[model samples]
Target: MAIVLFALPLAVVVQRLYHDETVTGLERDATRIAAVVPDDLIQRPRPLKRPAGLPSRLTVGVYRVDGRRVTGQGPGRSALAVRGRDGRVHDGAEHGRLAVAAPVPSDEGVAAIVRVSAPYDPTGDRIQRALLAMAGLALAAVACASLLARYLARRLARPLERLTAAAQRLGAGNFSVRAPRSGVREADEAGIALEATARRLGTILERERAFSADVSHQLRTPLTGLLLGLESALERPGADLSAAIGTALDRGHRLQVIIDELLDLARDTEPARRHLDVPAELEEITLRWHGPLAAQGRRLVLDIQHPLPAVSTSPAALSQIMDVLLGNALQHGRGEVTVQAADVGGGIAIDVGDQGPGIAEDAPDIFARRSAHPSAPRGTGRDAGQAGTRTAAAAGHGIGLALARSLAEAEGGRLILRSSGPTVFTLFLPDTSMAS
Candidate 1:
């Protein structure tokens, strides 16, 4: 486009210059012929016509000293005057005549004006031909430029297109699409970066998968023994022992719940995503938990916005996140718990707010293994002196918030602590695509 823009005007100017030079040359030859004519011819005006050595197309006219026409011949009766000064041609146009006037030297005090005229039609024709030639050249230049632009666009776009495809594949959990290297240095650099990212991601995913499997394997034996022991205790033969056994069984059950949560978290690295209506899902969860909330003397409020878009997420993962949020509320809250859902641009968003003792300022540290917050209730004597042991045993359970965040991220979403007051904790889940 840049080249065409300059070339077009340049061609037009060149064409005009060539035509002007041609017309000036023709006028100069006519002036020279008029100069050689004898002085006697100027005083007595007659048809002293020259032979055919000059161009037959040329037209000539002679005028007396008083500007009266002497001889006129050609397409038009009127002729243009040619003025000569230092052997240079000067042109003038008047009275339907395009003129080049020159002075003819004479012994008589009166000098003669030699004028030449050609019909404007021939000059117009030459200009039209010149324009036509320029148009053709412009057309040819445009064709070549178009081809070049297309070739350049293709060369630049091909690598970017491959990168797009590779990104889509990565999004689909296929991390094996390597971009083909081609084109310039910048393109090669981008390809190399993509390949490196894929390799690192593949390695990280493989490690996570292996770690999950190993954790499941290592915990199987202890989990089984704990379950069996609780069952045997429940079947004990004495009333007092049975009561003790029941208390032990309750503790064992809590441990079992913790282990189950861990297994779910480990397996939740990859989640099945599906579109779910936000209002409907929230209603169902609220219904299921209504009895429990009422039993605890807490009011559950639904402040859902209708017509929310369906969110792409894993149902199980979403449920687990909600469970952790609600469970934390129930365990710690003293008043109302509110659940709300709404549309936030590209996807649906859900927030669960509880009138509980809100997250401690140091809550983030709880995500680390064995890091205990001062706010957590201390265990009784039976579990005392067991802080280190219990910390190790319950290591996986305290990561509920962390698990919620991880599960949300796996489904291309985020779990955030929106706001925390003295007695409020709000958990907000927003789809990643919506934020983007």
Candidate 2:
């Protein structure tokens, strides 16, 4: 549309300019012929000599003041010749041709007139040719602009298209899909934002699944123990019913604690850290695990080095981690299970070690979710039989240490296997004073 608007006016200007140039040439020729006229031509009414090198398309004539033409190939009576009698020049269309007249000057006011006329076809043809050239150039500009517009549109749209597809897949729960990159900055930034959203959604979903599994595994022991104690009390003749009820209540309370801690671990946001007294914390864990270990003829020992610094961590997280370690030792270790806490520079270090045939050299990744503990004894849990123990190596150890390690990292701490022979696992927490 813009091109047409510009080209239409430009075409008109070209046509007018060409026509005007032709008329200007005629006026120049007429003035030249008038200048060289013999002074007695108006009185004699004879032929005037045509100018040298006059254009063939142009016709020249000498006319009287009353519009009578004497010499020229044009109408005998010319209106333009009569109009030029007042010592002025005039130009207009005359008999389908362009004509211009210049008056001759004499001592007496007005004399003869010189007229030049030409057919309009040549001027019209040149104007038409010029307009055609302009139209062709306009069309070429339109074509180039169209191609450039298409290229720009696709460059801006392709990245958004990819992001749309990725978002659709993500909405459908395919969290693995990623957005593509384009060179455009705005589109690339949008794609990056979409990718970050996908990652967060994926992490939240994974944590939810882990939360469900964690609840089941962590609650299994206490729940089973509660049920088994109640069953035993019913089976025994004249059993202490009140004592059995009290034991069941304790086990139920423990289940609640496990649930609360698991919920804390499963949240998308990190919990606030608190200063923990290492020895005091371990003392409570030992009290809880002591009876369970004693029932299996094993002792739980808590040893602490003096002047232990306060470590920063979530209290529930710390408790759960200790519970997992103690539970593991109870189910699979021999002799004594010792929890040793000491002041290590820049941090506090705690080691949970057991006297048992440690993890096998071949089974290096015991903390992996799918890896079965090679040193786990036969028929470890309540529901396991001899046959179950035979295949226990194939039944992966649940996400106990893995959950513990994750919880520790959330508190900005580290958990690692410091030894294999004695099966000592070390947990290091940054000292709260040092952190400050």
Candidate 3:
């Protein structure tokens, strides 16, 4: 647009200037012709000596006042004489061609006129040539600029295009995909950041998959054992049918508890918290697990501090935590397993401990996902063969105890391994019964 604006008007001005200069030269030639012409020849038919090198295109005419050409013969000599005062050149047309006419002065004032003319084409040719040159230069410059701009834009846009494609793949669950870095500083930085995010997302998804596998394994083991135990008890001749069925039902209830705990762990939301009677809830849970532990020859002692302080926690979350602790106690624990409740300052404490050998020095990282040793008893062991009750989840210490601790913390409580000798796991929750 700018090229057009500047070039077109400039072409017009150059053409006009060239035409005006031609007119100026014609006027000067006309004045000289008038000065040399004799007065006697002006009123009568006469001719002057035409110069030897006279321009072929220049047309000069000396005309009488009545408009008759008398002096020199030229192209379009039939133009009328224009009378002008002083040396002023009067612009007029000679036939159809452009010409300059001026008065030839005599003692009596104006008597005849001298005119000069040339075809206007040569001046137009010069101007057109000059304008064409300017236009060519301008177009070349614009072409160069456009090429440079395209190159620079591709440099910047290529990296962004790769990033966009990688993002799409990642959103489609292809976390292994990565964006390659462009040499441009800004694009390289973005690629680096995007690659990091993909790695983090892949790691998180891997852990979740592993967690799911662990949960499935933990749940299926006990259910299998319970089925086996039920089949064995029912197969025996003269077995008490009611007792065997009752035991199978108890095992089914324990299996259900394991599922419930896993479900709670799977929930993305925090556990619900409210004022709960800690002692009453613990008492109920102990009784629920007492049957399976007794079947395994372990005594359960519920030692509750009278008038226990009410703790702020969800009953479901607290019950699951206790189940985890009690399950841990029953697997590797021996003798009497105790569910002891006490009121500490501003909180309630429940200690589920066992008189078993406890975590051995050899059982390091007892809370890891899998036990270090095959026979090593870790918190929340996965063996359900001992008792198909609340203590069902076995060895991986990874799922149950971790899930229990997570639930406790979510409900504004804490669960910790308080002692190794008695293998005591203590749960502390803030008392909120008096809170408004």
Candidate 4:
């Protein structure tokens, strides 16, 4: 296809140039022979010798005005000669063969005419051979070009095929799949972008899965406690109706609190600018988890460096973040968990530290959604959904921490892993309450 597009025009141009050169040489030879005639030929007729460099097939004829071949064998016609005119070569025919003619000048005015002729058979055979050779060369060039085009087309097509497959998988909910980069520049660029989109989609999906699973993590503990309380009440002989109802109501209230916090986490709305009492929020959150920590034989300590001032942050967001931190401490930490507060900038810094064998140094990407504890089993909350151990073991830190940090930053705050020796994570919220 490429050969047809480019080679045909090239062949035409080459042939035209060659044909023009051949004709120009022929006309020039005729004029040269006419100019070199000796003066003695006018008085007495003599056969002209073939001019040097003239084709052997070309025959010359000298004629009087009336049209007669004086020496060579050719058609004798008066119109074949361009007499007493400028050096413009005109077409002359000699017995059905192509030729060129020019007038022979002398001391006498318009003395004689000389016509040069070449046999049509030989001239045409030479031209046909040249055309055949040119055609063959053109075909070879076209074949080579076709091969090159096919190679380039295949090179480009394979990457696009991979990209198409990747797109199909993406549409099929396989966001983890990626396309490999082909060496072709444009295809490589597209492949890079395709893989990039795949990574983004995979992140979004993993977060969604974690979000749904998070409900199980946060609510399962309270739900389990509520169930156990009802089960205990049922087991009692002649249980007091008012007492059971009160116990159930209390457990239900705790579950509602968990649900409301989870709902706030899922809202995806911007935080309202307001002053938050960090110490008060810290004390309340610690109190909520006090029972769970005491059950696990671990100590929960609060270290206040100063009279912590109020900062600009949402209480609901802070509560949810504390849940993740304290819940992690309860489930995974050893010894004691200390939550410290301090004054920093226009806000306060709250550090949640767990005295456990902190995260391993080689544990990859701290924020990417992946397993935190490789040995710990993963489940969908079928077993171990009790109040003491929620879904914390199954819900990895990657999902929890990533969400916590994103939420913190979205509300114009910062979350950082201060130290891994004790696995300390610090939270800082700026004072946005004064902003317009």
Give one digit per residue, the lDDT tens place, for model 1 in 39-98: 776557678575457666656766654556666553323333323422345565555445
**Best-performing candidate as measured by TM-score:** 2
**Model 4 over residues 108-150: C-alpha lDDT tens digits?**
6556666776666655566567678767877898788889989
By lDDT, the candidates rank as: 2, 3, 4, 1
**Per-candidate TM-score against the hidden true structure:** 0.47, 0.70, 0.58, 0.56
- Residue pairs with backbone atoms closer than 3 Å in model 4 (clashes): none
Q: What number of clashing residue pairs does each candidate have, in the order they appear?
A: 8, 0, 6, 0
The models' CA-based lDDT, in order, is 0.59, 0.78, 0.71, 0.69
Give the per-residue lDDT of model 3 (tens digit) for 1-436.
8778987898888887887888888888778788877777764667676555657798877776655676776543344463444445686555556688777878887767777778766766787888888889888978987999899899889999999999999999998877887799998889888888998788667646644754664555466556656666667777776876776787788778767766655553446656687667877888877866877777999998877776666676777678778877766688999888887877788888888877766765655454323443321312333354444456546666766676677677888888888688999887776553
Over 4 Å off, model 3: 1-74, 77-122, 161-193, 229-233, 236-291, 294-323, 335-352, 371-391, 396-418, 425-436
Query: In model 1, what lDDT does residue 217 have?
Result: 30
Best-to-worst TM-score order: 2, 3, 4, 1
Clashing pairs in 2: none
In the order shown, the candidates' Cα RMSDs to the true structure are 16.1, 6.3, 7.9, 9.1
Q: Quote the lDDT for 424 in model 3.
A: 89
Query: How well does candidate 2 score on lDDT at residue 154?
Result: 92
| Candidate that would win on lDDT | 2
Error of 4 at 145 (Å): 2.4
